[model samples]
Target chain A: MDVFLQTLVAGILKGGLYALIGIGMTLIMGVMGIINLAHGQLMMVAMYITYVLHLAGVDPYISLFVAMPALFLLGCLIQRFLLNPLLKVDTILPENQVLMTVGIGMVLTEIIRFIFKSDYKSVSTGYSNATFFLGNISFSIALGISFIIAIAFTVAMFFFLIKTDIGRSIRATAQDKDAAVLMGVNTGRITIITFGLGSGLVAAAGCLLAPVYYVFPDIGGPFTARAFIITILGGLGSTVGAIFGGVTLGLAESFGATYISMDYENIIGMTIFVLVLLFLPGGFKRLTKI
Target chain B: MLKVDAIDVFYGDLQVLWGSSFEVREKEIVVLVGANGAGKSTTLKTISGLLRPKAGTIVFDGVRLDRLPADRIIGHGVVHVPEARRLFREMSVEENMVMGSLAPEARKKRRETLAWVYELFPRMKERRKQAAGTLSGGEQQMCAIGRGLMALPRLLMFDEPSLGLAPILVEDVFNIVKRINKEGVTVLLVEQNVRQTLALCDRAYVLENGSVVLQGTGKELLADPHVKEAYLGL
Candidate 1:
């Protein structure tokens, strides 16, 4: 029973960080109606920024202040110069924009590879490996801190979306673009800001994970796949759905790692993803209206 | 207050509107009536800057609007209440209303505008907390109009406001439109219900196959032989 509870606690804590990552991807997906395939690549860039700052004797947590805003600017540039121009392109297949993101992912990965190389760099800090025991269960202090930060950010994000005018404009743009236009929402500017916000959020997740995980150019590929899976498992644009999707994925992966073969961790996630696709096609969005 | 002079619009390769020109004087309720695919909605969209004109110009109160973006057009006090009640489904009705008044000028008067809108559509007030998606069809239409009113438009446009509603509710929506016009807001309405719209409007333009084929006072058009033959089926 203690073993089970230990795994559950581990899953929930990890899930918090996953929710942060998923929220970023989902918000972009919701507002833009296109997947930022470079989402994890952007996170990888943030992680590298944190890593470089760490080399300069800055703690990873402190590096967040730099990494997040840098990534936000980068994301805004991508939207302004790269993605927003596609709106006028009159492409036969709308998927061309999505393909552009995939290309962007490749370019970002290669650029980071050129700069940081393929060597796996560890962001080991004083507290990275520290843990505390609660009865027979143990929790990593870093993971606990990240979980709290993630929850705080998630709560703050909800507040921003609920209470602010810009947030309402974003939601309005996502819901019915024509109505938003009629209401005087500058959707072009909204898209740029939304992309920036999404990048900043994913950057936060990247910084949170940097101390607990290794930084490598290739690390982004797997997390990119995971981000899309979380988006699909949730709903295309549902924030609440992304949270549930992240938690469900984290729990499934944790349980699979503990009981099933360690090699089958991805397979377990894939199986659940397939099941949800088959049975609950719309994901948690259909269940939770918001 | 508004002038659309010989505007030609195309959707990609296909031309949807050809030299469509009309005018809406301040405080007049003008209707654009036509069958499906006749470019009634396209006219509204073009005027609102959703689609740019290939030729001619759209001038509102002496400033050209054809070159502006959709959102910027709204800043000039033109608000469109679109077809099918495109309310934000997940947002509460109140929130949806709140979205209409997001611009700085409109935001300043949000409190008074909201109160006035609530008085105009009491159903919206009663169900302001509910998700807009859950409202009955007519109530959703009223809520959409209420949202448009929240924008404090100098010239308000409605596209197919009575689509997909019961016959009884159709008259109610039309009466609301007339009431709104009576309260001193200029209106540009698009509709397929020729008989009722012609009677309710002060003036109207008849569109057929993307061209403004006819125009006059509502009673004049109602009495025209061509209109009676083609649209009224007299």
Candidate 2:
């Protein structure tokens, strides 16, 4: 029972961070109607930025602001310069944009490899290994802080989507592109902003995870797969569903690592993903209806 | 006032409209009556900047609109309540209306326009919090019109607004269009419901196979033999 409780606590903490990453991918999916295969690469870029700032004696937490905005700009550039032009290209397959993103992911990974040499790197903050006990469960301090911050960001994002005009415009664009255009939404620009916002959200997750997870040029591939699974598990574009999907994945991974084998952690996640596709095809969003 | 002067529109080499010319004077209820493939909707789309004209120009109040994008076209107060009532399905009725006022100029008058839209379509006010997709067909059409009104448009265009409604609802929609026109907004309506639209509009244009075949006052065209045979089935 004690071991079960400890595992549950750890899973929830990790799930919070996963929710942040999932939310970004889901947002991009919702607005652009294209899965961003480079989403994990964007996070990888943010992690590298956080690492560089950490090396310069800046705290990882403080680098969150820098990494997020930098990523937002980078995302805007990617959408405007790379993705937007594809809308005009005559293609037999509508998945050309998806293929373009895969290419982008490869390019980003290669560029980072060229610069950082694929070395496994990590940030060692003061609380990187610190732990606290609550009853029988022990929580890592870094994970706890990240969990709180992730919740804050999620709440903030919810308010932004519901309360703000620009956020409403984003939702409108996602719902119907032609209608949004007729409504004077400048939807092209909205896509750019949505991409930026998605990148910014994932950058926060990357910064939060820097202290806990090792960073490397090739680390993006796994996270990219994880993010895709979460989006599918959560429903394609539902924000609330992303949170549930992320948590479910985190718990599954945690339990698998604890009871089965660490080597099967990813396999466990993939198995759940397949089950979700087979059964709840619309994902948790169909359940939540949000 | 809006004037579309001899514009050609194509959908990937298959021309949908060929040198179609029409004009709407200020405060007038102008209707474009045609069959399914007569380019009625295509004309409205060209005016709204959804599809750029291959040749010729569209002028609204003396400014050329042919070169602008769809989003920018709304800034000139040319709001299109598109065919099939393309309301944001996942959004609430109120959110849909709010989206209608997305332009900076329209946003300034959002509260006023929203109140007026509610006044025009009180059912929309009651269903403000309901998701638009869940609404009945008539209610969805009402919401679509209400959304267009929220833009505070100088020229409001409707594309086949009465396409799928019952006879009673169709009458209600026409009355609403008349009421909207009386409120000082110029109307450019495209419809296949020929007799009723001609009866309501001040002036009417008859389109056949992507070109304007006839144009005159509503009463004049209603009496024309060509119009009666081609459109009114008389």
Candidate 3:
């Protein structure tokens, strides 16, 4: 029983990292109506940045401050130059966008591979293996920190989307770009900023994940797939839904590993995804359509 | 004052506005009445900076607007409330209204304008927390107009504001337009409902095949033989 509870705690902690990555994906996809296959690659790049910073003796946590804004600016530039033209183009066909983003992802991963090979790299902090106890449950300090930071990032994103002037523009543009422009929203600027913010969150996620997972140029593929599942399950563009879906996925994986063979984890996750696709018809239909 | 001078616009190779011209004096409610595909909305769009004129210029308060982008045109106090009540559906009523003030002055006086908007549409205030998608047709129209008001525009243009509205609701909405105009905002209203629009407008322009064929005071245009025979169903 104690071992089962321990696995549960670990799973939930890991779920935090998943939620962090998925939230970034959801924000970009939900607002821009483009499924960024390059998202995972962006995360991988951030992970590499964190890894390099750690290798140079900077703490991974401190590297977040450096990585986020850099990634954000990169995202903004990409949106302003590359994606803004596509805004005039149609996005109803998901395949066209998927192909475009897949190409971008490939280019990004290859660039990183050309510079930093495909070898695994990880950030080793001083408290990498540190833990804390809450009653009978043992919590890894690193995981707890990631979870707290993840929630904080999500909260900040929510406030931005809801409270500030620019945030309102993002939401307005997401709903209807034509209407947003009609309402005097500089959609070009909004798209650039939103893309930057989304990419920045991915950077933060990568930094948090570096200390917990083995990082490499190709590491983002699995995380991206996991994010795809979580975003769909939670309803796309829903910040709160991403966190809940992540925790649920984490618990499921833990239970599947314990009761069944650990090798069946992937199978279990895919099965749930298939079931959701079949049964839900539309995930979170109550959500107001933009 | 606004002047849309002999502007020609096209959708691909097909011409939508051919030498369309009209003028709205300051604080006047000017109505453009036309049949389907007559380019009434297109004229409004051209003047509001959504579509540029291929041949002519839109002059608002003596400043030419052909070079400005749609959002930038709002700085000159020209705002378009598009057809179909294009409120941001996923956001709350308050959020949608807040977005209306995305223009510089609106952003600066956000608090004052927001309170005024809620006062203008009390129903919106009641459902301030509700998602705009859930609002009824009339309520959505109110939100759209309220949003345009938030911009503090000098010239507020409405496109087909009466579309899809009930008869009673249409009267209420037109009354609101008159009220908004009386509040010292110049209004350029585009409508399919010729009779009611003529009833409220200070002056009227009749558009046909993308050009203004008739222009006069509201009563003068209403009394014209062609307008009486074709539009008033008299």
Best by lDDT: 2
lDDT (10s digit) by residue, model 1, range A97-185 = 78988999899999999998899998999999999999989999999999999999999999998899999989889888877887889
Off by over 4 Å in 3: A87-97, A285-290
**lDDT per model, in order?**
0.91, 0.93, 0.84
lDDT of 2 by residue, A1-290 (tens): 99999889888999998999999999999998999999899999999999999999999999999999999999999999999999999989998888989999999999999999988999999999999888878899999999999999999999999889999989988989888989888889999999999999999999999999999998888899999999999999999999999999999999999999989999999999999999999999888998
Candidate 1 residue B197 C-alpha distance from true site, Å? 1.6
- Show pairs that collide, candidate 1: none
TM-score of chain A of each: 0.98, 0.99, 0.91
TM-score versus the correct structure, for each prediction: 0.97, 0.98, 0.95
Better of 1 and 3 by DockQ: 3
Task: Give the lowest summed-lDDT range of ten residues in model 3 chain A.
Answer: A281-290
Residue A284 of candidate 1: its Cα lDDT? 84
What residue runs in model 2 are displaced by over 4 Å at the alpha carbon? none
Residue A31 in model 2: lDDT? 93
Cα miss at A57, model 2 (Å)? 1.4
Clashing pairs in model 2? none
Tens digit of lDDT per residue, candidate 1, span B1-234? 999999889998899999989999999999999889999998888988888899989999988998888888777788899889889887999999999898788899999999999999988889999999899999999989999988888899999999999999999999999898989899999999999999999999999999999999999999999999999999
lDDT measured at residue B17 in model 2 versus the true structure, 0 to 100? 94
lDDT of 3 by residue, A1-290 (tens): 88789888888887877777777777787678877778878888888889889989998889999899989998888777776776578667646656766887788899999998988877878778888888787888888898889878888888887889888888788788888888877877877887788789989988988887798889877767777887776777776677766776777787889889799887777777788788874544334232
RMSD for each of the candidates: 1.4, 1.1, 2.2
Return whichever of 2 and 3 wins on lDDT. 2
